[model samples]
Each structure stands twice: as structure tokens, then as C-alpha cells.
Target chain A: MATWLLLTLAAAAADFQDQDKQGHPTRAVLLGGSGEAHWNAGASVGSPWTTVTVQRGLRGGWTPLAEVQAASFARWQPAVGVGKRWIDRRWRLTGEGTVGWTLQGDPIPFRGPAAELRVKGGRAVGRFAPYLHLGMRSSRTEDRVETVSGDILREEARWETTLTGALGTGFLLTDRVGIDIGLDLPWVHMPNPSIPGMHIGVQTGWGRNQ
Target chain B: MHTHGVSMVRTILPFAFLIACGPPPKGVDYRGTRLAVVDMHLHPGDWQQVPESTQGYLASRFPFPFGLRPEQVAEGVLTGEAILDQLDDAAVSAAILFAVYAPRTVGVATNELVLRERRADTSRLWGLASLPVDRWDESSEAALAALSEALDNPGMVGIKLAHAHMHFRMDDPAYFSIYDMAVAHDAPVYLHTGTSPFPGTRTEPEYTDPAYLEAAIATHPRVQFILGHMGYDFIDQRPGDADTAIDLAVRYDNVWLEPSALGSRGSDPTGTNLPLVLKKAKTAGVEARLIYGSDGPQSPGFAADYLERTLTALEAADYSVEEAQLILADNASSLFGIPTFKAEK
Candidate 1:
């Protein structure tokens, strides 16, 4: 399926102009959903995690994003981030960072403050772009979720981390609209880690913002 | 662009349908040995009652993920109908549903809900009563009264306790009276006997060690104690108390070793430890004392996957067919008196 999609995308790219090199940077707002299967993690520990994201593309290749992730809708983690992108004929690359909060759920012992850093790269043809993303995410969990809202008397904590990656293609419907779809690959807390997942996103923007 | 967008939807729709409509779960094929399955450990909860942490965990347990919010999906699956549908999908003959009251951790799935669900009429669902132990000193009497009442009902087979999640110590003599209640009711006790990853659970040996309950096991010999998770420490990711649990089961006849959650990817990615534990039980000639519990329904098809995982582990341990039957179905049936299943001739 992936091979067929990539071949089609390559064929489409051949007919389109390199607007990435000639036109202005994209400034768009995006909304999307993501899902990952953690059955491989541990039946008790891994929940089919689904996440929703909202993003704002800023001027001069800067972007800000926010998201809420749910582990089977049982737990929720919300995060905010910013990234910078560099585009050319062959690749559209981005580097981003974010901090996430485990607001409620079992926390079993405590909640979490998680941090992530990611990089994405892709190429565009006409309105289609296929990208690959790679990064790292880390979090601390224990009894009390450290938050801005409350006081903590004592904290017992541990660290968890994962290597994050994704492969997807984006389609620009018009000068102001587009969609992105991909598979997310994360190696969580390795020796053993999590498996690949899926995400879909939609966006609208002012094109060629010179 | 509109055409392209339409095309994109058309392309993705098939994938969505595929996820929504998964292949019917073809449950564990017992080869030639006809073995019925009774899943001893499962937690059920309401969407509103579940803590966000638990809600997150519940979201992905099912096989499908589309057309609804994650919580909405969980809310749907938590229902009696959905539970039964899931059970059918996994080919589970019957299941034991636990009533959870750990508000600080997983949240509540009340005893009343367990009894109220219509699934009880189908005989596919059974109950394990859980009491509110967070306020032990203040409400122990009322809690026991409620528990006793719950146990009096049909299909209420056991008492489920989590020393770690309920913020209690196993050896706290003050709480040991609960065992006396177990003795009177003829209900077996299922205790969470190892470190849990859930926040707020007590991880110390006092709370999690299977050895901590030896005295209680001895004192209440009439009351059976089924050690849950087989002292598998999920947080530390080691076989935390498997040896102690196996030792206790070997030493004490009233104790039953339950190796639940040992087959999970998070606990044992290589599928290594459970087979060893099974081998140890067979070696010790304690297979009859072993009861099978998947600790599942975690993700949609997990109950079936866990059963298959466990049965595979049984094969890995080289457990003979008779030992497998004892561990898989016979032991649970002997204790609960649930009706039996004979494989089709």
C-alpha cells in the first residue's frame, strides 16, 4: 500500500512546479487526529492511545502547535510546542519542541510532565508532500501530577522516554487548504518499546506569504 | 482541489471501514484438547467514574479506533452489550468482572453496576466484589456490610482487593478481619500481590509482596487466597514476587497462583517469564493450585489475545495437556462452580 501511494505521489510530483523553492513560506492552521496500538507494550500498561492536535503556522517558517493525547480515553496528556522549518527543492524540513502534561487519570502514583523534540522532512510536488518525522520524548511520572494549579507535599517519581518517528504524505487542496496522513513509529523506553501508529491532519493557510 | 479532497476521503474510507470491521476473533485453538476458558481477572468501569488516567488506558483496549472520541468509544464498550459483544468476539465462554473502588487510581466500577447489568442473566458474566478501603478506619464496618451483601448474591464468586491501589498494607492486622468475612461467605479472595504501575499504589513489600500475606493465608486457611499478577512487579519490570507467590502456593494449599498480566507486552516483551513461571509450577507439582486469569479486556481484543498468549506460554513451559486443563479451566470451575465447557466432538 505504501509503495503504491509513494509511486503515485512521485508521478504527481513530476508534473508540478517547485513552489517550495519559488513561492513564499506556508502559514496555515491544522487540525488532526492520531492513533497508536500499545498491545505490544503490556496488555495492562498499553492502551490504544489516540491524540488530537491543533496547529498554527507562523510567519517566516515558524510554527506553534498544541495537542491532547488520550490513552484509551482513560488518561489525557496535553502539550504545547513550537518549531522552525527550512524548505528547498528536494526537502521541506522542520525542527520542533514541546512540553506535555498528564492532567488526570491513574497517574497510579502521580501525574507527569513530559517533554519532546522532533524533526520532520518531506518533499512536495504540486500539492502533494510526503514526509518523515523523527524525534525523542521523555516524561516523569509518580503520585502527584506536578501542575501550576496545586501544591505538593512529597513527590516520588520515575522517568520514561521514547524515540518518536512518523511517515506521511500531505495534499494541498488549494492555495489555502491541505491534508496530511502518516504512520507513527515510536520506540518507547527501549530494550522493548511501542509499535507504529497512524495520524490524519487537515490544514488551511495563506499561501506564498512573502 | 475539491476533487482531490473527495478522492482522499474515498481512499481513506476503506481503511476506516477495515479498522471498524475487524476479522472476527478466532480464539485460541486448543489443538485437539478440548479446554474451556474462564478469565478470572477483568476490571470494568464507567466513563464518568473512571479517572482520566484510567480513561486513557481504556481507550485503546478494543480493536477498532474510529467514528467516535476515545472516551466515547470507552463509554460504549463499558456497557453490558458491548462487553458481551467483546466476549463473543474473543470466544470467551464466560468472564469474571471485578468491581473497582480505587478512586485514587483506576476509579470505580461499583458492585451495584456489576449486579445491575443485564449480562448476568446471560450467565456469561460473574462478579467479584470490591470494597472501598481508602477510608478503612472510618468506614470498615459499612464497607464489610456492603461486601457481605454483595457476596450473598448469585454469581458473586470472590472478593477483589488491591493493597497497593487501595493504599493499605497486606499485614495490617486491623484489616485482616476482611479475611474472616471471606471465610464466612465461602468466597475466594483475589489479591493484587505485586507492585502496580498505577500512581498512588503502595509499592513497598508490605503492600505488594506476596509473602506479606502468608500469615493471613495461614490464619484463614478456610478462605482461599488467589494471588493476582503472580507478584509480577509491572513498574520495576521484573518477576517481582513470582518466586514468593509460587512458594506460598506450594507451601499453602489454600493459596492459588494467578499469573495474570504476565503476558503483556509492557511486562514481558520477549514472552519469557510466564513460561518459566508455568514450568516452575509444573516442576513443583503445583499445577492444580494454578488458576488462569488474563487480567484483560484492556484493549478491545485483549481478552482473547491474553488467553492465547497464556496458552502459548503453557506450551512453551511444556505443560502436558492435563496440566493445561487444570490451569486453564478446571481449577477455576472447582472454586467457582461455574458451568463447564466441553470441546465439540
Candidate 2:
């Protein structure tokens, strides 16, 4: 998904530069990494799972972006997302949506689509521009455990989801390439029925467009 | 050299300045203030040899309330390093390592090996010897010899007797010989008064009842009697409390209680009933008789974390901080006749 997103965004950037009659994009490729949903399926036979994503930015804001990404963590799923960047002098806004599938693991097969909206602003340095981001995420799971031994032994599969808000900062390596690291906590419900808990994720990613 | 000396002076100056700037403090004997406590009940498992299947079997047959799963037991067994680490972290002075085994022919060698290993680490490990009561007729000599040798090893503290194995009452005239040996050696006898995880025993030792211990205590008043599990039965229809047992300890100064199974076993196996035991101890005025113990590896409730929580619970049970210190350290020292009872700094 990340690869495809990057390629599409790069193509869009080239077209926008040509249309501007500048021949050169004032914006470089935005290289950034992200953590996306591997699977969010709840405790049932078939629930959608989410993956964590990290990415790199290739250039400045204003060019559209798209990518296809395979997770190094969750073995059975892959994803693709596309979005456009609207850049103001010092501020950048990005919107993207992703779709993917997770293979069945002993108990559950997951399938789902997710959407992300992000806004970031920061001071730009020579090759190091640090920016903060805010975004929202949601996912579901389907899986459960039952007592095969007797009726009295009660075991249930759990399903959970969350609404999340994040505060993070990343540095751009150059006009087209840089790394972003951020921490996000889900305030919504967690699927594991044992305890009401929260998850914190740190994501990093990079990209390039000509 | 001059520049290096100046750099050293610069680094040292702040520390000296801080000390000089502080008010003069009261001189205190901090070394002897805190007691060094070592729990005697620990089961370190041999994960390499015990199969997961075996562990599963152990768990299913003896569930958490009865027994911990093999992995839990295995973890408890290998937990020596972790326990030592916690002890180091918690400032525990030493630990008396012991094991739990059923009364079977194979159990003899296993128990002996455990004792030998525990004895090897005399500096920190006080190996408690286990005896197979059923095999006493055949293995008594071997058991006696092994225990004598281990006790003679300078680190081996005392003898650990589990009632589940013997099935004979504490008052049984037969155990007198064993008591005689322990008394002769000036070694303490730690007895388990609890229900066995497995059935099938020779006599179903009724003497485990705290009431029965009176006769033995009366007769062997000089022999140190360490009542393991705090004289309470894990599955007793009529469990004895600290009040009944404290009478024994108060009557005979030789009598003591090692709270090994305090957090595990009993009807409320999760240790929900522990406060009751601690209460009875405090009420009975036997708080100092309680020692830090955990029937480990076999009992799921006896972990390092459990030990900490147990102490916290005891402290909360209105036990005086000093009494809690004694129960956690001084009591075990007095019972085992350890001279240097203070926590090592």
C-alpha cells in the first residue's frame, strides 16, 4: 500500500508541476513512514484486523500520494492507500484511506477498510523540518474461545475498537525525504475482554517523488 | 596531570559542597536495623527435562486451587534466579531453598538431589531436607544419612517434613526416632500440616492437626518444631487457626510457624483467607512466630510477587512494623538458630 501510494503521489506531483508551467515542483517528494492497521477484527470467526505502519516522505506538500505496503509484523496481510496533500506556506494537510485483508489464523479471518485524516505544521530547516501531526483511527476484530471441556467453564472470544487522537513530531531529511516518529494512544474500547486497557504505537516511515 | 587533577577536583567539589551544606544528622546503626529474611519454601523446576505434556497433566490433575500447571511449576522452579534478583532488589539477606515431592519411590532421589543442590550454595542457600515418610522403613537410613551429611555441610539448616507423605499423626510414636535425630543434631523439624495434592497414603496422618502437635511439643520441648503452613490444613474440614497453634508456640518456645502456604492452598486458594491467618497470628500474639514462606513450584500462589504482596497484606493486617520485620526475618532466624539475623548492607 505504501509503495503504491508513493508512486501515485509522485505521478500526481509530476503532473501538477507540469500543469503549473514551472517544470520543477517547488515541492519535493515527501518521504515518511507510518504505522497502519494490521487488523482490527473483533473476537469472532471473521473480523477485520489492523496493521501498524511507518513511512518516509519524499517531497514537500501539495502533490497527491498513494502506496501499497506489506507488513513485516503481521505475516498474512497487505494494504494500499491514496491521498492528496494540500500545502500552505508553512502548514500541510493530508487525507488518505486504506483497504486490506488478514488471513485466518486458527480462529479468525479478518477483512476491513480504514480512513485517516492528518494535519501538520512546523518550522522548516535546511534538511531537517520537524512537524506535528493529529489524526483519527478505528478497527474491529472477530474471535472467541469456548470451554471444550464442560458447560460451567465459560470462555468467550473478544472483539474491540477505539477512537484515537495522536500528537507526534517528525523531521524531514530533505525536500523529498525524511523520517517521522509519533506516539498514539487509542481512547476507545480495547477488544481483549480480560481488562480495559490502552495501546501506544510509535511509527516511522520514508518516501521520494520526482 | 595538573589539568586532570583540576578536572577531578571540579568533579569532587560539588559532592563535597552538597555534604558540607547539609545539617549534621543523627548517627544510626543502619546495618542491624533491618532484618534479613529468606523464605524456606521454593521449588525450582527442571524445564529442560520436564515435558510440556507432563506439565499439562500436572496442571489438569491439580488445578491452580490444587496445583499449578507444569509451566507455572517450571517457571516457579526456574524462578530461583528471579527470586534471588528480587531478594537482591528487596534487600532479602538469604533464602532457604526447598522442594515439594509426592511420597513415591522415585520421589526419594529427586528430593535428595534437590537437597544436595540447595546445600551446595551455603553462602546464600540454606537447604531444607525432605523425607519420604512412606519409605521410612526402607529409605530411613539413606534419608537419615543424607540429611545428617547435608546438615553437617554448615549450610543445611533443618529437616522439612510434609504431612501428605507420611499419613501418620504428628503424635505417632514412630516419628519419635526422626525427632530424636533432629534434636540430637540441634536441627529444627519443619512439618507440613496440609492436604496432599494426591491421595493414597499409609496412615492419613491425623497428627497434622495442631491439636495433636501438643503431645509432640510436650515430649520434645527442647527439639525445635517449625510448624509449616502455619499449622493450618489446605483441605481440612476442621482447619486450625493461629489461635490454636499460637497456644502451642507460646507454651513451647521451641514451637514456630513458617507461613509457607500462607498465600496458597486452603479453601480460598487465591489467598483470600490469608488475612484471617495473619489476624489469628496477631490476635494470638504469635506474629513473631510467623516466618516468610511460600509452598512454591507446586503452589501457584507462592511467587516472588506473591511474597511481596503477602508481606504487604500482613503489614496491613495491623501487625506492628517491628513484628512484621521479625516475621519476615527475625522469626526465621530464631527458629533456624541463625546468628547474624540482621539484613546485610
Candidate 3:
């Protein structure tokens, strides 16, 4: 459903703020990396996570993206998808959908396919862009079902879901270089439920066309 | 050369991190005592019969490298022998095998399985029977009958309930009859309090808080209420309802505090919560009411690790050797009527 919605938005939305007069996108490739650390209130830091992303703007307000995300200091999940962003002057809105695999989820209790949907809205004030994001993530892991005699009759699939809401501000130090910091509220599904976390990142790319 | 050495150090660090799988934990001193070290919480399940989600949770927490999961180790292995070996590794005297019926959360470890495993070393192993409450509305009587019969076995020492995992309210009177059965059979009721990290467990204060059980605890004066986890919310690492549990223990003779699973890295990775709870229990002067349980045999070295963690916390909490003995062995021995050396004479 998220993918379909993203596709519909991409098709219906026009790049009024991002396209040149010839109807070509002005934005280019972006490479971003982020590190997340839990807010343990000074005693000890909880689960540490990192993510790296690549994005390229497409025509009609669409952007194609791929990312690798590792979490809890040991688990890794990589996803790829497309997004649509709308801009009216300094105001921005984005919707994206991604699918990935739990490449390695030790200490996270899952292994297999996963997906996410994110919607972010932000407004720029000079060099800083403040944003609010809401995201929904779902993943699948497998288990064996056995009869009373202990024979594996079949493999059952268990799906786990969690939500994330974040508020962050982006700093554009230079025309093509930027930094981002965010406070993240992630609902971790397996083992434990959730924890407070924050993220810091740097990205290099073309400035958003306006 | 320095750059090459730095790269080598980086390569070795991740490998070291991934090697959380092996180098089996060595047994430690049981506080330099030979008193009966009874671990009252052990979930021994047949690998084939236990749910895969449970296996996943165990494997995820105890990260076995090269895809050799800890949950797979017990396959075709002797369940009882494996449990006894775990006890030996942890330097514990005996451990109770609990039959869990949490079909919604961790899956079921049937009473039959618990009985079958206890036969491996009846002298050193015990069983705690639980009723299957999934269909309790239709089969409460039959389930009670099965529970009654299981309790009749000499090895079945108590009743086990995880209301959070079992999807029941504490004040719900439909299950009050279980306490009546416990009173009649002279069995203590060991119930899970506070929060569980497992998926599908109810985390509401209604289910996880022991305050909801206050009325029941008051009414069932003849029934001993051993609150498990000492109200430690494992998922959140908070001292959940420990004050209420301590108050109950102080207010009523039948109420007891169990500190099982409070020492696990999942629950208290910094080793702070357990000491805090132990200090409070000490302040309340209910050291004798504190029973030791590991919630153990979770993974390869989890039992040993949890035991070591608990001991470290006890030391940090300023518990003496004798108090440690009470928490570790003597108290449970007295509660369950397990014959110690003095009793055997």
C-alpha cells in the first residue's frame, strides 16, 4: 500500500520547485551517513546504530534511494525504495517506501524480509531546515512448527512491526554540504519494547532546488 | 606498520564481538557454601516442541556465530541430562522445571514434558505445574483436575503462572480456584510480576503490577504468593512495582519476593537494578523471603551468566554470605520442602 501510494504521488505531483524551465530536475546524487546512540541518562549508552544512504532525484518530484542500516550494535538490515518530495518555497514534504532483508539480526531476534514507510515534513529557515518524521516498519522471521512427536511439520512466519517518530534540524554549512541531528523515538518490537535515541549525520549533495 | 596494526585491531574487534557464542562459561563459587542452592525457575522444553519465536528470542540474545544457534544445541540431546549439566556448570544444587502454558507469548512447555525431564534426576530436579488457560472458559475444571493430579506427584512442588504471558487479569476471580487448589495441596504459587520482554506479553499495570493481586493475596492467607522477578520490568530496566511487592511481603507472611531474571543483561546490563532491589529488600528486612531463581537455561551460557551477574549484584548490594545463602538455597529449600543435609538426618 505504501509503495502504491508513493507511486501515485510521484506520478501525480509536479516538480514545480525542483525542475528547471526545461522540466528537468536540478538536484543530483546525495550520500549520507548517520550514527544513532541511545540516551542512557549519563550512566551507560544503550544500543548504538549506524546507517548510510544514497539518493538520486528523478523527474516529477520522485527520488530513488537505497540504504544500509545496522542497529543495536550488531544487527543489519538493508533496504531500497523510491520517494516523492513536494516543495512550496521553503516548505517541504516527503513520502517514501522501502523493502529490505534482515541480513544479520543477532541480538535482535529476527532474520528475513522487512519494509518501511516514512513521511517527513520540514520548513527551512535560512541555513537550517527543521523536520518532523513519522515512520512505520515491518519485518518477518521464521519459526518451525512441530507435532507432538517433535517432527517439523512446517515453517511458520512471524511478522513484527514497530513505529518511529523523530524531530530533527538540518544545517547547510556550505552550498553542497550539510549536517543533521535528530531526536528519535523508536518502538523496538523484539525482546524489549522501546528506548529513546538520537542521531547525527552528514550528507553531501546538491542543495534542494527552489 | 602502525596503520596495518590499526586495521588488524579493527578486524579482530568485530570477530571478538561475534564470538559471543562459545567458550562455555565456567562454574563459579556458590558463595562458598554447600547449602541447598535451589534455582526455582527453569523452563526445560523439547527443542522440537518449543515455539520458534522462543528459539529466535534466545538465539538473538545469545548470538551464536556461523549460524549455529544455541536453541538448536538441545536437539536430540537428553533434556534432563542437559539441564543437570547446566546446573553443574552454574554450581547449583537443584533446579525446578516449570511447565509454562503461555501459548500467546513463548509457547507451551507442557506438564508432561516437565515430568518427563524431571525423571532424569528426580533427586536433584523438580517440576512446577501450570494449567492451560487458553480454553479455560470451557475446560477450567478439567485443567484444574490435571493440575491437581500433577501436584500429587512427589516432584511437583508448586504452581507457576505468568499472567502477562498467559493473558489474564490479576483480580479476575475466575482463576481464584487455582489458589484454593494451592491451599488444599499445600503448594506455593509462583507468579510472574512486572514486565516481560517477550513479544505478545501484556505490559499493562493491570497485568504486570502486583498491587492488583493485593486482594487475592489477602484472601488466600493459607496460600503462599511468591512474586517472580521481584517486580523488575525486564524490557524497560525499571524497578517495577518492587516497592509494592516489598510492602506486600512485609504486610503479609504468605507474600514472598523472587529476584529471578533481574540480573540478566537484558534486564540490567549496567548491574544497577538488581542491587537497588536487593538494597530495598534488605532495608525492608525480608531477606529470608527473597528466593533465588535464574529464569534459566535460556541459552548456552545464559544460566551461568545470569547466576554470575546475580552474585555480582548481591555483592554490590552488601548481602552477607549467610544472606546470600538464604536467597540462593536455604530459603527455597524451606519454601519447597526440599530435604537438605540437616533435614535428611
Candidate 4:
């Protein structure tokens, strides 16, 4: 489902970019890595995750984006949102808000809706851009079969919130392609799998000149 | 573009610096506090040697409450070497092995097997001789002789009796000689004082009641008596048996409560009635008399789950690290006269 969502978004973004007479950036990015990559390899909790996102520049400083995250443990999430960017001299400021739904099917199948807000800032030094991002997400589940600490128990919908932050440097390989490396810190305190204290993620993106 | 870069940096750098300098991680470091773990109740015997009828009964009751499956019980039967490997994986310093003494319903695990295993690694394994009351002669000479022989073995630290399966009252005078022998040798006497899970077994709860041990405890005041299950009444969930067990421990300085069946309900750190037992023991001011016991290797996955759940439960209940340490190993070390890991260190 996440893959299909990504493909659909990519197609829509490509069509929008082609129809516009003015050259605008149309970007596709891929995110893939284990949450425990920075910690011991054996200490990984849950599963490795991959995400794909497509963003199309709109009028003014606004951009519309869509993303999908696919993971082992039968987890899938699809999100859509709009972002605004402000460029002042050598730095760029960005903010985005997304609403998504999560589906899981390990111990038992369950689905939940989630909302996230992210803010980021980056400064371009020649071909490299170093950036920092802070994000917060809140999720709530519908009534589903719940596995409470490994025991099968039926529970009503519940809400959970997580805070995430990242620091990274993006290298512009070409005018249309770039690579990013970052440390992702996701704070999840619930009694789930052992969440790694820190994780490293690498993402690649292709885009046209703005 | 230059202004854009400077403005963005100015807006985000301070926030980034603040977040990067934030406090480390919240929550306690559960693994940092090292505690020597000693499992005071482990049935490390070959289940293949179990009676055919008993095997059938266990097999039919697949998925026992304590996360034990009959197939896993058969598959998990470990040799002496395998037992050591399990202990290493669990970070357990030592374990007390019990030979099941239910001769009538289930075949007895010979004292010879337990002695041999303990002798193989005396530092890590301790043996408890199982005495069959039915095998005792009219004068109880056979029971006394067996207990004496077991105590003679350097690896045998105690004697275990199954009153439920053996159909003998715990306070029966016929077993007084065995208690006397334990006192003479300074060995603790372990009794199965709880409900057995075997459905078709000939066990009588009345025979195994914790209250019956009062007379025996009084009679053998010098001998240390360890209640194997703390008089757990699993079927009825009655608090009476457990209260009696705690009262006995509180009343007698020589009595201890070993919660072997505490982890029988899977890995819900707080599952089972163990926390209740701990709370009661704390209130009774006999918390030091509480000991840890897995009663395990019952299934392939049981031992680890048992140890993890037990520790997690203790930590979750806000048990002081010192109190948890005592229950984990110190109490057992003092009661059995075994050298604790701290002493060796």
C-alpha cells in the first residue's frame, strides 16, 4: 500500500511539473535504514523501514508533498501534506505538517491515524547543505485486538505521542540529484520493542532546479 | 541567497544547540545494577524418564499456564552440560536442582541423577534429594537412611519432599526422622506446598497445605524449612494458602518462602501473583526471607522468560535494589550455605 501510494504521488508530481511552463523543482526522495543502525546491530527493535516521498514546488514559497513508509512487522503508513520554504541569502527555512494512517499486522491486525509537524533549517555552503530538523507526532488507534505486553487482550483505542529530531548534511551530487546522511533520534517510551538510542539514515533525492 | 542562508542559520542554530544539549535519557538503567542470580527451585531432570501415563497427561494439557508446552518440556530436558549452558545464558550464578519425588503418579527422579549432575559442577549446581514417603519402611528407617546418604554427598545441600503426590500429611510423625536428619546435617528441607498443575494427578491439596507445616516447623525448629511454592493455590486463587505461608515465614526465623511458580503466567512483568507475594512479604517484615526460583527448564523458552519477568516485576514494584538483590541470590546463599558470587569476587 505504501509503495502504491508513493508511485501514485510520484506520477502526480511528474505530471504537475511537466504542465507548468516555468521550471520548478519536482523531487522524489527515498529513505531506508534500520532504527538501530547507530547502536549494536543485534539490539534492533521492530524492523527496518523504508520511506518514499514526492514533493512538487507550487506558486510562491509553498510545496505540496506526499510520503509512504514501509516496514517489516507488517507496518505501513501513508502521509500527505504541504510545506512552506523561505530562502534568505545562503539559508533555507522549512515547515511541514502531515496527516497519516498506520496499519500493523504482527500479533494482531490494527490500524491507527497519526499527525506530525516538522520544522527544519539548512544553510548551503557551496554544494553542501547542513540541516537540523525537529518533529512531533501524535497517533491514536481505533478499537482493535490489542496484544498487551505479549498477552492477547482486547482494548479500546489508545493514543501515543513521540518526539523526533535529526541533524544531517546534504551533498548535492549534481544539479538534479542529492544525497543526505543524518542521525535520527526517536523517543518512544512505551513498552514495545527495544528502541535504539540513536540511528543513522541516508536518503537520496532527485529534483529539478527551483 | 546569502541573506537567505544567514537568516535560516540564525533562526535554527540556537534551537539545534539547545536540543543537542538536552538531558540524556530518562528511565532507570535496569542492567547497570549487577545482582548475582541464584534460582532456588529448578527441576533439571530428564522428562523422558517420566512415567508414560504422566507424560500422556502432560502432553494433553498443552500450553500450561507458565508458558510450558508438553513438547517443549520433552525437548528442553537438558544434560548436566546443557544446564550449565542455560545458566550462563541467564546470567545465573547457581541453581538448586530438585528431583521430583512423586513416585506413585509420576516416576521419581532418582537422587543418583541429581547427585551426579551436582557433582559435575558443584560451584554452579546444588542437589536436593527427593525422599519418597511410601518407600519408607514402617520405622521410617529407609527415609532416614536415604536422607543421610544424600546429606553425605558434598553436592547435596538439602532434601525435598512432595507431600501432595506422596499423599502424606506434612506434619505426619512418619516424616519426623527425615526432618531430624536435616537438622542434624544443617540442611534445609524443601517441601512442595502448593497446587500441582497435573490434571489427573492423585495430588491432594489438603495434604500439601502450608498450615500443616506449622507443627513440623515447631517440631524441627532448628531445621530450615523452605516452602517451594509459598503455598500457591493456583486453581482457586485463594489468598489463604499464601497468607499462611507468609505467616509461617514471619513466625519462624528458620522458614523461607521460595516463589518457584511466580513466572508460570508468561512474560507480563507484573503478571501472576508474585508482586502480591512480594508486597505481603514486605509488609510482614520477612522480605529478606523471600527467594527467587524459576521451577524451570520446564519448557524450552521458560527459563529466560521466567528470569526476565521476575526481575522486571521486582523493579516495577519499586523494590529497592538491595531487597531485589537479596531475593535474587543473597537469601538463597545464606540459607543453603553456598558461597555467594560476591564472596568469590
The candidate scoring highest on TM-score is: 1
Model 1 chain A worst lDDT window (10 residues): A34-43
- Order the candidates by TM-score, highest first — what do you get? 1, 3, 4, 2
Go through the candidates in order and give each one's DockQ. 0.10, 0.05, 0.07, 0.02
User: What shift in Å separates residue A1 of candidate 3 from its native position after superposition?
Assistant: 77
What DockQ would candidate 4 receive versus the native complex?
0.02
Give the per-residue Cα lDDT of candidate 4 at A98: 88
Off by over 4 Å in 2: A1-210, B1-35, B45-54, B57-76, B79-83, B99-112, B119-121, B197-207, B236-243, B264-272, B297-302, B339-345
**Model 4 Cα shift for residue B156 (angstroms):** 0.3
| Candidate topping DockQ | 1
- lDDT tens digits, residues A1-210, model 2? 999998876765454334221111112212222212111111101111123342323234322334332221222434455444544333444544444443322112333444444444443333233444444544444433334474444434433233433343434322333343443333332331111122222222222222
Ranking by DockQ: 1, 3, 2, 4
Each candidate structure's count of clashing pairs: 38, 93, 0, 14
lDDT of 4 by residue, A43-62 (tens): 11222345566665555656
**How would the docking of model 3 be graded?**
incorrect
Q: Candidate 4 regions off by >4 Å?
A: A1-210, B1-32, B60-76, B135-139, B200-205, B237-240, B266-272, B343-345
